[model samples]
Target: MRLLITGGAGFIGANFVHSSVRVHPEDSLTVLDAMTYAGSRESLAAVENDIRLVQGDITDAELANKLVAESDAVVHFAAETHVDNALADPEPFLRANVIGTFTVLEAVRAHGVRLHHVSTDEVYGDLELGNARRFTESTPYNPSSPYSSTKAASDMLVRAWVRSYGVRATISNCSNNYGPYQHVEKFIPRQITNVLTGRRPKLYGSGTNVRDWIHVDDHNSAVRRILADGQIGRTYLIGAEEERDNLSVMRAILRLMDRDPDDFDHVADRAGHDLRYAIDPSALYDELGWAPKHTDFEDGLRATIDWYRDNETWWGPLKDATEAKYEGRGQ
Candidate 1:
């Protein structure tokens, strides 16, 4: 299959590209990325010789149509994903998440190409700290942040296209992902990098907020399954059932790096921060027989720490810039 993956140079997308190239030798891939700050060529360096990289925006109608016209399937992963950045400036999120998705949907519709839309669990808002309820495919949309709201809008556009225009499309809403190649601005990497650089990890508020963590490779595996055999117009929730609070995650990272568990600072909490996000991926597991290989959070974190420690060349250039951005925000 010839696959066109948008945002293929970004964290999750690049991981997907690597997984595809390594696991599916018969498939060919063309990655369409805008080369934004979060998206880097280095992320795809390992698979650069194996896949085609197109430095273009998803909002470009002509480019999107041209790429989709020639591909067997489209995996839409491009977006303005940082919630903190969205809180400060939402215009980019709207343009990249909403309009970008519309452009992809139109191209897929015109060419009759199958599409898999990658989304986040934040679209369903947050669950209470102690609530037993987990987000399912049937959860109602209640996005709190600009980033999530735009993603929710994009998800709706895909559904609209599928129902109103009969576009072959599937959507997957996944939880927080951590693994190698993730940007340092995110929570896990930020803490890991901080410890590596001899700085204390920083937590927000009381660090009580919880998230369902999934390994990036596991997420990519589920995406592949959905792209190959999922029902059109259906939504799948992808998670590994590894739920941990922010403080716990910080302690685990510190322990892995041989730092004190309490060796961290508490910054101001994010505005409109969601309390918890847990995904119920039973439908994906039961119907598609998809199961996560990285169910142990600490084991995954140790592997991720090892990767960052061993591959400073890959993440070093962007570390100072990412930390500078966060420092300016007082986070």
Candidate 2:
């Protein structure tokens, strides 16, 4: 199979590319990335020689169409995904998430190629902190921030194209992903990097916000499973069933790094912050016989810490800028 992966230099997409190379050596892979601030070629360093890397914008319909025409499947992952960034300026999110998705949808629809649209569970908005209900495939979207709203729009576009144009597509809305190659701005990497750099971790508000965490590898594995056996016009939710509140995760990181659990500062939380997000991935588990290998949150988090500890060169350059941005916001 020939695969064209958009945003393959970014976190989850890069991990997906690396895993695909190892698991399916026969498939030819091509990556299209814009090399945005959040994306780096260094993330794809390990598999650089194995896959063709094309630096381009996904919103370019001509580029998207040319690549889609020559591929068996396209995994659309390009987007402006940072919530903080999106909240500050929504124009980029609108252009990339909405227009980029439309470009890819048109290309795939024209070429009659299969597509897998990766999305986040934030589109379902927040459930009350103690609520037992989790987001499922049928959950109605209630996006709270510009980031999630754009993603929600992209997901809807994929669904509409599937029904309206008979486009072959599948969508998977995943929970929070934490593993290597993740940007430092994300919660897990930010705190982990802070401790590694001799800084105290920062917690937002009361730190009660909960997120269903899943290892990056586990998330990608489920994506591959969906591509192989998932039905068309279907949306699958992917999660590891490892839900942890912000305070608990912060304390765990500090404890693992030999710091006092309560040694962190409390920063003002962002506006419209969701209280909780949980995903029910029963459809992926029952229908596709898929499960996450990293069921232990602390263990996976430990491995993630080790990755940052050992790969300072990979994240060191961006640390100061990232911290400065947060510090400027008084967060």
Candidate 3:
């Protein structure tokens, strides 16, 4: 099958590219990305020759139509994904998440191609303490932050296209993903890099914010399975069923690095911080036989720490920029 993956150079996108090329060598995988700072080309360095990559923004309808016209499926993974960045400025978020998704939906409709959209559980917003409302395929969205609000909007647009235009589409909303090649700005990488370099790990609020953590590799597998066998017009939530508070995750990282727990720097919480988010992947597991296969959080943390330490050059630039930004250099 011929596949077109937008934002294939970004963290999870790049991982999917590699996963596709290796697992489905007979399939054609072409990537379209604008090469934004968060979308690093180096992530695809190893598989550069195995797949076709087009550097362009998904907002360009002409380009989107052209790419979708040639592919049997389009996995839309490109978006402005940083929460803080979205809080600071939302225009780019609209252009990337909302406008880009609209353009992608239109292009796929024009081409009569199937679309698989990648989304986050954050769109469901904060979970009340001890309350069990794991996001299901039918959960109502209540986005709290700018980033999630835009994603929720994009999700609505995808659903509209699927229902109104008869466009075949499958959407997957995943939990927090952490593994290799993730941009350093994310929670896992930021904490890992910070503690490894003998710096304090920053904890937002009391760090009690809960997240369902999943290994990126496991996530990639779930997406591939969904693309291969998932029913159309369905939204699947792929979760590892491992929920941990933000502080617990941080301490796991510190322990993995053999660092002191006091290295965690307690910081003031950001506006509209979600208290928790948990997802139940029962639908995906029961229908598609998709269940996560990864080490426990501790094991995964150790392996991830080793990766960041060994691949310094790969993550070095991003780590340096993150430090510089903290020092008030780049704006």
Candidate 4:
């Protein structure tokens, strides 16, 4: 099959490309990436020969239509994903996440191509810290940040397109993803790179906020399954059932890096920060027989740390600028 993957140079999308190339040799891919600050060409270096990379925006209607017209399927992954950036300036997120998704949907509808929309669990907002409830497919939309709100809007667009235009599309709202090639600005990579650079990990507020963590490989695997067998107009929640608080994650990273667990600083928490986010992937498992391979968070974190350690040349150049951005915000 020929696939067009938007934001293919970014973390999760790059991992998806790598996985597809390795597992499905018969498939061909064309990656459309804006090459924003978070999206790096180096992330796709290993699979460069296997896939065609197009430096473009997903919001470009003509480009999206042309690409979708020629592809068997489209995986929409392009977005301004950082919550901090969204809080500071939401215009980019609005353009990339909402307008970009509209463009892709229109193209897919016009071309009659299958599409898989990648989204986040944050769109469901936060649950009570100790609540037994997890985000299910029926969870109501309650986005707290501009980033998540835009994603929510995009998801709605996909649904409306499916019902109104009969567009073949599936949506997957996944938990936090951590693996190699992730930008240093993200939570896990920021802490990991901080320890590597001889800086203490920074926690926000009291570090009680929790997040459901999933490995990027597992997330991509589920996405592939959805693309292959998932029902159109359906939504799946992809998670590993591994829930951990911010402080615990920080301490674990420090311990894995052979540092003191308490060697961290408490910075101001993010505005409108959700208390917790947990995903119930029972439907994904019972319906599609999908399960996460990396269930052990520590093992995954260790592997992720090793990747960052061994590939300093890849993440080193971005560390300084990333830290500076955070420092400037007093975060």
Candidate 5:
């Protein structure tokens, strides 16, 4: 199969691209990425020779149309995904997440190609801490931040196209992902890189915010499963059911790195920070027989730490600037 993977040089997308090359050697892969500050070519270094990487904006309708016209399937992953960045300025998020998705929707609609839209569970907003309820396929949209609102809009666009234009598309909303090639601005990688660089980890607010964490590889595997066997016009939630609070996760990182658990500093939390997010991936499992392999969160963290430790050259250049941006926000 010939596949067009948008944003394939970004964190989860890069991992997906690598896995595609390793697992589906018979398939030809092409990656379209804008190489934004959050994305880097170095992330695709290992699989650079295995796939074709196109550096272009997804909002370019002509480019999106040309690529979609030649592909068997298109996995759309390009977007401005950082909450902090979106909070600072929402214009880019509107352009990338909304307009870019519109472009992709039109292309796939025009070409009669299958499409899988990758989304985040944040679009369901946050559940109260200690709530037993988790987000499922039936959850209503209640996006909190500009970043999530844009993603919610994109997801809506896919659903609308599927109904209105008969576009062959499916959607998967995933929980928080942590693994290699992730940007330093994200929570887990920021803390891990801080420890490796001799800086204390920073926790937000009381550190009670809970997030359902899943390894990137596991997330990508579930996505592949959906693309292969999932029913059209259905939305599946992907999660490993690994729920951890910020404080506990930070303490675990500190303990694993041989530091005092309470050595971390507390920073002001961002406005509209969701108290918790949990996902129930029952539909993904029961309907598609998909299950996450990285069930052990600590083990995943250890491997992730090792990756960042060994690949300092890949993350080091962006550390200072990332921290500086956070510092400005007092978070």
Candidate 6:
């Protein structure tokens, strides 16, 4: 089997590629990434030569069509992922997340390749009432920000292709992911690297925002399953159910690094930030026979922190840029 993964040089996507290649040696992988600032080659250093790496924007229909034509399956992960990045200027988000997705859908329709649309739980906005039923496959999308609106739009487009062209498709909306090869601009690694080198972790507002986090490996496993046996047009919610507030998650990371809790900075809240994004993966568990293998947040945090600590050179240059930019990419 040959798979084409967009945004393969980015954090979760790169980890997925590494994990997939290690597990399925017989399967060939092709990664198409634009190599944006957030999409670093360092994450994919080990597999650059092993897997074909095509550097091009997904909005280019010609490139997208060519890549899809060469693969057995297409995993759509290319998008301007940050909420602030999207809010700052939504044009790029629309072009990449929405139009870029359409480009992929058209290519797959022409090439007869299966598609797994990698989506996010943020598409279902804040649920301020009633037990907060985990956002399931049936949850109606209520996107609260530009980032999520584009993703929701793309998700709708994928469904359109499934109905209009009889294309095989599966959508997985995963929770916030935290693991190795992440840029320092993200919350977890930003905090860990900041305190480790005597910088303050800058957090937004009250830090009360809630999110469920999953290990990248666990997410990769779910994607593999969706590719293997998921029914066409099925939407799977992939998460570890390890829900934690932003403040709590940061403190937990501090505990892992044996650092003082005071080594942090709090600021005004971001515009249009959702209070919580929780999802129920019971449907995927019931139907796909898949459950999270690493549900322990503490153990996952330990391993993630150790990965950054051991590989300083990989994420070292990113620390100053993270602080100078006053930007972060997680809950």
TM-score of every model versus the real structure: 0.99, 0.99, 0.96, 0.99, 0.99, 0.96
Model 6 error, position 19 (Å): 0.5
Which residue pairs does candidate 6 place in steric collision? none
lDDT of 5 by residue, 9-65 (tens): 999999999999999999999999999997899999988989999999999999999
lDDT by residue for model 4 over 13-98, one digit each (tens)? 99999999999989989999999998999999988999999999888999998999989999989999999999999999999999
Deviating ranges (above 4 Å) for candidate 4: none
State, as a TM-score between 0 and 1, how close model 1 is to the true structure: 0.99
List the global CA lDDT of all models: 0.95, 0.95, 0.89, 0.95, 0.95, 0.87
Q: Report the lDDT tens digits of candidate 2 across residue range 1-331.
A: 9999999999999999999999999999999999999889999999999999999999999999999999999998898999999988999999999999999999999999999999999999999988899998888999999999999999999999999999999999999999999999999999999998888889999999999999999999999999989999999999999989999999999999988999999998998999999999999999999999998989999999999999999999999999999999998
For model 1, the stretches where C-alpha displacement exceeds 4 angstroms are: none
Model 6 scores worst on lDDT over the 10 consecutive residues at 322-331
- The weakest ten consecutive residues by lDDT in model 1 span 193-202
- Model 3: residues >4 Å from true position, as ranges? 327-331
Q: What is the lDDT of residue 202 in candidate 3?
A: 85
Deviation in Å, model 4, residue 248 alpha carbon: 0.5
Candidate 2: clashing pairs of residues: none
In model 6, the runs with Cα more than 4 Å from the true position are 327-331
In model 6, the Cα lDDT at residue 198 comes to: 83
Residue by residue across 1-331, what tens digits does model 6's lDDT show?
A: 9899999998888998899889988888999999888888888898777788889999899998888988999988888888876877899899989999999999999998999999999999986633567788888899999999999999999999999998889999999999999888777888889877887777888888888899989998999998898999989999999888899988888877887765677876889878887889998888889988888899999999999989999988877876766645342
Task: Count steric clashes of candidate 3.
Answer: 0
